[model samples]
Target: MASDSDRLRALKAFDNTKAGVKGLVDTGITTIPSIFHHPLPLHRLHADQEHHFTIPVIDLAAAMGATTTTTAPSERAELVATVKAAVETVGFFQVVNHGVPKAVMSEMLAALQGFHEETVEAKAPYYSRDSRRRVRYQSNFNLFRSPAATWHDTLFMETAPEPTPPEEIPPACRTIVPEYTRLVQQLGRTLLELLSEALGLHRGHLEEDAACLEGLAGHYYPSCPEPHLTLGTTAHSDPCFLTVVLQNAVGGLQVLVDGLQEDDKKKSDAVWVDVPVVAGALVVNVGDFLQLVSNGKFKSVEHRVVAKSVGPRVSVACFFRPQGAATSTRVLQPIVTNGEARYRSTTMAELVRRYRAKGLYGSSLLQHLSL
Candidate 1:
C-alpha cells in the first residue's frame, strides 16, 4: 500500500485538475490511479454472477389508458400486486409505457450527453462540491472520506418544491429539463400510490406520510481506460423514498438480490443481477427511507454501477425525498408491520445527513438504525 501522505498528495493533484475521471482517461491512463482501486469485498461478488433470473419488467400501458381516464379499480389493484411482489423479492422493477413520452426521454438523454461531452472549459463553471448549489457538476463528493473514488461524474440539481432557475442549468440539456421534470414528478406520485396500496394502506398514505416526491440527481459515467480497476459507482442503497432512473442502452447497472434459500445467502459469491435497459422504461428502486418508513415492508437492496471500456453511459435519477418540515420532523410510521419495529423512529433529515456523510460506499444507514 502507498503511504498516507503520498495518497493524499495524489488525491489533491487529481482534484485540482477539475476534469474528473474523464480527464484522467483523456491523459491515457493505462492503469487506474491508486485512489480509484476498489476493495476486494467491493468486487468479489461480481466475479461469479451466474444469475438465472432476470429482473421483473412490468407493463402499465393498460392502466394508464388512452384518454387519461382514472384507472379501473381492478386494474389498479392488479398493478399494485405486480409492484408489491417485485419490491418484496427484488426491491426494483422496470415500468414500460408508463405515460412518459419516448421523445421527451430522448431529448433528456441528448441533453445529458450534450453537457457531459462539452469541453472542460464550457463545463467548468458549474463544477462545484457544495450540495447547496442549485446546479453543479463534480466527481466523487466523498473522495476525501471514502477508501477509494469511483469513476463517474454527477450533475446534481433540485427540480421540485421548486425547479432550479433556467440560467443555472447547463445549456446542453436545458431545453428538455422542464418537461422531463414534470413527467417524472407525475410518475413519482403514481409509484408512491402504488407502493402505498402494496403495503395494504390507502393510496395516499405514502404521499401524505413521507415526502415521496422531491428532486432529481443525474450522473454521467464516461468510458474508463482502466475499467477493471475501478467502479463507476460503489455498492450502495439510495437514501430517499424512491429513485426513478432513465438510462441509455449502454447498461452497467446491477442490483443485489439474495436467494430465498439459506444456502444461497451463505455462499461467498454474490447474487448480483444485471438490470437491462429497455427502451422507454424507467427503473424504480425502493430506497432506505421507504424501507424504514414501512418498517421493512418494502425492501431496500444494494445496487451499483460497473466500469466499462465502452463509450459514455448516461442516466438521470429523480429522487422523491420528503419536502419542507416533513423532511426533518416527520416520524416514520409503518402501516404494514412485519413484527416489531426493527428500527427506531427518526427524522428523514438526520438519516439523510448521516447517509450523505457516509457517501455511496454500499454501507447502509438502515442497519445502523436497526434495534
Candidate 2:
C-alpha cells in the first residue's frame, strides 16, 4: 500500500511543477513512476477481433441538417431509431456529416497538438486548478484523489454559460477553441433534439428541461515508454447529459459492454470493441445525467484509453449540461409513459459537485444517484 505521506508528497511535487505527464516523460524516465501505475490488480483486457464487432455510425447531415424541420417523416424516424439503438446498447456512436467542417475539425486538432507539444516553459502559465478560471491546463482533475494519475495533460474551457474571455485563453489556442465551441454547441443542440425524440419526448424537452451549458476539454496523451503502467483515461462514465468527443487517427478508445467483463457481470458479451477512427466523425455518448433522467433506459457505460508507443492521442470532448445550479435544479420529469421518476429530482450542479468531489475510483455518478 502507498503510504498517505508518500502519495501526498509525490502528488504535491508533480502538481507544483504544473508540467503534467508530458513533463515527466521529457525527463526520459524508463520506468513509470509509482503515481502513474494502476492502483488495483491489473487485468489485461482482450480486444475483440476487428471483424467481430463494429461501433454504430450515424450520418446526421441529411437528418439533422438545414432540412431537418422539413425532412421526410420516414427519414427522420429511421435516424431516430438508429440513434436510440446505439444509446441502448453501447451508449455511444460515431456521427458523420455533423455539419462541422472537416477543415475546422482538423485545424482545431492541429492547434491543440501544437499547444500541448510546446515547451514546458511555454505552457506553464496556463496551468491551473481553479474552477473559476475558464481556460486552464491541468494533468488530472482528481489528481489528488485518484489512485493513480493518467498519462495525459488537458486544456479545459467552459464555454456554455459563458466562454472564457478571449484575453484569458492562451493566445495561440484562443481562436480555435471558441470557434469549435460554437460549432459543437450548435451540433450539440441538434443532438439533444434527436435524443429527445429518441426518448419519445417532445422535441424540445431536453433543451428546455436540462440546462444548455457546455464544456470542452482537450486531452493530450504523450507516448509512454512503459505504456502498460498508465492509462490515458480510466474507466468512468461522463457526468453530463451528453458528450461529443473528437479524436485524431491515433486510436486507443475502448468502451466497456457490461456483460462482457467477467469481473463486472455475467458473460453475455465477452470483450471490448475498438472505437476505430473514422475520418470526420465525432464520437457521441449518452451521459450519466441522461441515464438518470431516463430512468435507466439510456446507457452511460464506462470507457478508457490505453497508452501506446504512438506519440500523441489527442481528443477534445464537449460536455452538455445545465448552465448553473438554478437551471439544473429542476426535477427530472418522469417519462410520460412510465409516470415514475427513478431517481430523485436534482440539479446538474449537485451532480457535478458530487462528481468533482469524488475521484474515478468509486461508483459512477449515475449509480450514486440511483434509487
Candidate 3:
C-alpha cells in the first residue's frame, strides 16, 4: 500500500505537470491514477437504480413577459412564488428563454473545451496555484486537501465585482467568456431581484443592498478510463448566495433530493436524481449564503457530477456572492421574519473559511452555523 508520503508525492507530481486531466488523457493512459481513486464503497459508487424525479423548469418568458416593465404584476408575483417554492424545497430549478442567446452559450462551452484541449504549452501560462490570480487554470482547486481528486480541470475567471482583464484570459476563451459573463451577470441580478421579492423584501434588496458579486468557473471533465471508481465532481453545495449553471447536452449532473414523502420531513432520506438536459436551459440552485440569509427558509442542496467513459463533458457555472469577504468586515445575517433566526450571523469570509476547512463530501457548513 502507498504510504501517506507516497500519495502526497504522486499528487505533487500531477500538480507540477500543470496540464490537467485532459493532459493525462492525452498521454493515452489506460487506467486512472491512484490519487483519483475515490474511497467510496462500490455500492454507493455504482448504484444501478433509476430515479424518475424531474426538477421543475420555469419559463422566464411567461413569467417576465418581454420585459419586467411590460409584465403584469400578477405574472411577476406568480414567478416569485414559483422561485420561492423551488428554493425552499429542492433548492434547484431550470430556466429557459432567460435572455442569453443559445449561440453565446454554445460558443462559451466550445471555447472552454477548446481552452482545455489546447496543447499543454499553450495553456501553461494561465496555470497556477495562486488564488490571488483573477484568471487561472488548475486541475483541482482542492487537490492537496480533498480526500480524492476528481477527473476534471477548471479555468476560473473572477468576473463580477470586477471583470477579469481581457488580456489575462486564455486566448481560446477571450471574447466569448467575457460576453457570457456579462449576460449571466444580468440574469443573476434578475434572479436575485425575484428572490428578494420572494423573501418579502423589495425587489432591489438582494441585488442592490446586499450587493452580490459574480464569479465564473469553466469546468472540463475529460473522459475517464475508470469512470466507476471516481467522479467528475464530488458532492458539495455551492458556498455562494446562488449558482447559475450552463451545461452541454452530454450531461451527468445529479442533485441529491428527498426520497421519502414530502410530509415525512422528519424521516428525511436523499436519493440521487439526474438533472435532465433541456436545450437552451440554465440550472439555478440556492447556495449556502442564500440559505443563511433566509434563515433556513431556503435550502442549499448537495449536487455532483459523475465521471463518464464517454468523451469530455463541459460546464460553465456563474456564482453570485459577496466580494472580498476575507478582508471585509461586513456581516451576513438572516432575513428575520415572524420572529426567530435559525442561524447565527457571520461574515462571508468566516463562512468561506469554515467551508474551506471542512472541504467537500462532508456534512454541510450549515450544521455548524445553525443556531
- Each model's backbone clash number: 2, 2, 0
TM-score of each: 0.93, 0.92, 0.94
The weakest ten consecutive residues by lDDT in model 2 span 43-52
lDDT of 2 by residue, 1-371 (tens): 67989999999999999888888888987788888888445524435663244689999965655574678888888888998988987898999999789999998899898888888888888898888777889999899888788889999888756677888877667888878888888888888888889988878888875546467788999888887777888878888888899999999998876444434344565356789999999999888888887788889888888888787899999888766555555665335356566666676677777888886667787665556
Clashing pairs in 3: none
- lDDT per prediction? 0.81, 0.81, 0.85
Model 3 misplaced regions, further than 4 Å: 46-52, 62-69, 209-211, 262-268, 325-327
User: How do the residues 1-371 of candidate 3 rate in per-residue lDDT, one tens digit apiece?
Assistant: 78999999999999999998998999999999989998766215543255445799987774432465788878888888998989988899999989899999999999999999899999999999898899989998999999889999999988756787888888899889878877877788788888998999987888853445557899999889999889999988988888999998888898888775555545445688788789999999999988999989888999989998996899999888777643257678899988899999888888778877777768888888888
Pick the winner on TM-score between candidates 2 and 3. Answer: 3
| Candidate 1: residue 312 lDDT (0-100) | 88
Q: Whose lDDT is higher: candidate 1's or candidate 3's?
A: 3
Please list all clashing residue pairs in model 1, or write none if there are none: 211-322, 235-362
lDDT of 1: 0.81
Among residues 3 or more apart in sequence or in different chains, the pairs in candidate 2 whose N, CA or C atoms overlap within 3 Å are 211-322, 328-347
